[model samples]
Target: MLIMNRKRMVEDKLDRLTKGQTAYAESRELIRLVKREIQNRQIPVLMDETDSGCWFIPQKNTTTPSDEQLAQM
Candidate 1:
């Protein structure tokens, strides 16, 4: 329930913001905010823009490489 509420809130804010801005400006701002929100929440998903629209893919693992792993490479 909490997660759904938060998701709805974020979606609502995005909708309201984009609705008030010009098309290209809104697109860029939405992209920037979405990136920031993803980082802030450590969302386990990846997003990208394609010819069709935004593509969201689930991430199996989002772990950062440790020093040992980096050293092995």
Candidate 2:
């Protein structure tokens, strides 16, 4: 439940970031919170910055499947 709440908070902040409705200064704390949560949870995602604001993005998976695995798929 706590994890879910944290996830929701991160999502809300990301939404505001994407909408470009909040000032960067105001969103700084929110960005910090999101970053802390990401680190604490070991989430497989990253935060990226843009001219307008910042947003979350899925991290690229580093592992590659072997030939047998690919064939099974």
Candidate 3:
């Protein structure tokens, strides 16, 4: 006959999953960028319309930005 501890098995799996999620966050970066432009439309207002685009980028590189680059912001 074989016996197993289900509680211990579940706890072990949870621990592994937590570690994996931490590793993924440390190894990935999510970037959001947006661009905008002005346009004229038929309305009482001077500028009634605008154009914009947003992007979400998921990068795998974990490289830290240089001090000079970071200083520019």
Candidate 4:
């Protein structure tokens, strides 16, 4: 679980920016990247639980992602 203060990241990126307007743009990109990574990690847990037919109450419903996405995950 990677937790980050987006405001801080934005400020830092902005501080370092030589070409961009603000840090928010860079921060948004970083967030998108982080989100994609987290989602990638989650697929296996979801697959494993679903494959095993485990009664994981919190994750009652499971639907597999597409093959290409699954491969990337």
TM values, all candidates: 0.38, 0.51, 0.27, 0.25
Give the Cα-based TM-score of candidate 4 against the true structure: 0.25
Q: In candidate 4, which residue ranges exceed 4 Å CA deviation?
A: 18-73
Of 1 and 2, the candidate ahead on lDDT is 2
Sort every candidate by TM-score, greatest first: 2, 1, 3, 4
The alpha-carbon deviation from the true structure for residue 15 of candidate 4, after best TM-score superposition, in angstroms, is 0.9
Model 1 lDDT per residue over 1-73, tens place: 4333444544654444334421111245455565566567665555656554454444556589999999999
List of clashing residue pairs for candidate 3: none
Q: What is candidate 3's TM-score against the reference? A: 0.27
| Clash totals in order | 0, 0, 0, 0
Clashing pairs in 2: none
lDDT digits (tens) for residues 1-73 of candidate 2 = 3334645667775555445433231256566777776577565665666655566664545899999999999
Residue-level lDDT tens digits of model 4 in 10-59: 44443333232222222445545433443554422221123323211112
The digit string of per-residue lDDT tens for model 3 on 1-73 reads 8754544433443343334321111111110101111112111112112233222222233578899989998
Instruction: Tell me how far the alpha carbon of residue 36 in candidate 2 is from the true structure, in angstroms, after superposition.
Output: 0.3
Candidates in order have lDDT scores of 0.51, 0.59, 0.28, 0.39
Q: After superposition, how far is residue 15 of candidate 2 from its true place, in Å?
A: 12
Q: Which 10 consecutive positions of candidate 4 have the poorest summed lDDT?
A: 51-60
